[model samples]
Target: MENTLQLDLNRSSHSCREDFSEYVAHLQLHMALQARNLVPNLTQAADSREQLLQETQAEFEKLVSRQMR
Candidate 1:
């Protein structure tokens, strides 16, 4: 009876390990997709923000072009 109980415990542990591995693989896949989706938008947002800053700077600097009497 003790041997049977030990065998059952071993089987349960093996199954749990397999399930954990599968869950990890799924999580990795989800994270990869999330990263892929974010990269392009993040890059584009940074570029757009830079362009806006440059345009605003040019406009503001133009105000300084006039001399104060």
Candidate 2:
């Protein structure tokens, strides 16, 4: 009886370990997917900011040139 109980406990522990491992793998995959989705959004935002800055600088230069004239 004691040996059977020990075997059962071992099986339960192994199952728990497997479940935890699967949960961790799923979480990692979700994080990776989220990061993949975020990267493009971040890149697009950066590009937009850069373009706006360039336009603003060009406008400022034009204003300065007109003032000098």
Candidate 3:
């Protein structure tokens, strides 16, 4: 009985370790996927902001030239 109990405990411990490791790996993969998704959105936002800035600058230059004339 004692030997059986010891074996059961060892199996439970090993199973718990495997479960924890799997959970950690799943979280890492989820975070990586989230980051992968976010990178393109962030990059697009940056590009849009840059484009807006350039358009605004061009409009401002045109206005300044019109005012000078």
Clashes of 3: 0
TM per prediction: 0.56, 0.57, 0.55
Model 2: which ten-residue window has the lowest total lDDT?
36-45
Report model 1's TM-score to 2 decimal places. 0.56
* Per-candidate alpha-carbon RMSD to the true structure: 19.4, 19.1, 19.3
Query: Compared with the true structure, what per-residue lDDT tens digits does model 2 show for residues 1-35?
Result: 99999999999999999899777766665655564
Positional deviation of residue 4's Cα in model 1 after best superposition, in angstroms: 0.7
TM-score of 2: 0.57
Off by over 4 Å in 2: 41-69
Candidate-wise lDDT, in order: 0.60, 0.63, 0.63
Q: Which residue segments of model 1 deviate by more than 4 Å?
A: 41-69
List model 1 lDDT by residue over 1-69, tens digit each: 999999999999999998997777666656555644543322233577766755554454354332111
Pick the TM-score winner: 2
Model 3 lDDT tens row, 1-69? 999999999999999998997777666656555644543332233577766755665565465445433
